[model samples]
Target: MRVKDKIHKLKILRVKAAKAMHADLQHELNAMHVYCHLRGFIGDRDALAFARKWERNIIYSHIIYRSINRSSNA
Candidate 1:
C-alpha cells in the first residue's frame, strides 16, 4: 500500500477509536452519577470502588486519544 493510503487508514482508525472512547467515557460518567446518587442506599463499598476504577479508565482513554491525535498530526 502507498504511504498515503496507509496514513488515511490510520486516520480513520484513530477517529473510530476516539469516538468509541468518548462513548465509553460518557457511559461511565452516567453510571458514576447514578452510583453517586445511590451511594448511601447501596452501602456496598466494592461498587463504589468499581465506579472509581471506571472513572480512571475513562481518564486513561482520554489520554490515549490525545496521544494518538498528537502522533497522527506529527
Candidate 2:
C-alpha cells in the first residue's frame, strides 16, 4: 500500500477525493453500514481498522479544537 492509499482508499471510490469530503468513517461501514464489518470475520482486518481509527482520530481532534477555541474566548 502506498503512503496516501492508507488514508482513504480512493482506489475504491467512484468520484475520487477531488469532489467533497464525506464518508469520514469506516470504509466497510461506508460500503455496507457496519462499524466492525470485518472485526472477526477476517483474520487480518487491518485496512478497515486503519480507516476507522483515523476517522475517529479526526473526529476527536475536531471536537478538541472547538473546545479549546470556546474556552479561550470565555
Candidate 3:
C-alpha cells in the first residue's frame, strides 16, 4: 500500500484506540511513530536509492530509519 494510505489507516486506528476504554496508549503512540516513519520513508526513499547507486555515499539514511524498519525486517 501507499505511504499516505498507511498513514491514513494508522490515524483512523489511533482514533478508534482513543475511543476504546481499555486501549493501551502505548499502542496508539507506537502506531503514530510508524505512521511518521512511513512518511519519512516515502520522503527519503528517492535520495536513498540515489545514494546507494552512487557507491554508498550516505553513511546513514534517517528517512529509512533503522528503528522504523526493524519490525518489517523481522
Instruction: Estimate, for each residue in 1-74, the C-alpha lDDT of model 3 and write its tens digit.
Output: 66556546654654454455344445545555464565564366653343233212111222234455677888
Using Cα atoms with residue i matched to residue i, what is each candidate's TM-score against the true structure?
0.51, 0.43, 0.34
Q: Which candidate is the best by TM-score?
A: 1
List model 2 lDDT by residue over 1-74, tens digit each: 54355334433332232122343434523542232343332333665556555445555655666687789999
- Give lDDT: candidate 3, residue 43: 65
What is the TM-score ranking, best to worst? Answer: 1, 2, 3
* Candidate closer to the true structure by TM-score (higher is better), 1 or 2: 1
For all predictions, the C-alpha RMSD in Å is: 14.7, 7.4, 14.4
User: Highest lDDT among the candidates is held by which one?
Assistant: 1
Model 2 spans > 4 angstroms off: 1-44
Candidate 1: list runs displaced more than 4 Å. 1-19, 22-31, 35-42
Clashing pairs in 3: none
Q: Model 2 lDDT vs. the true structure?
A: 0.44
Candidate lDDT scores, in order, read 0.56, 0.44, 0.46
Worst 10 residues of 3 by lDDT: 54-63
Model 1 Cα lDDT, one tens digit per residue, 1-74: 44345335434533454467646657656655564554341454654554465556566778888799899999
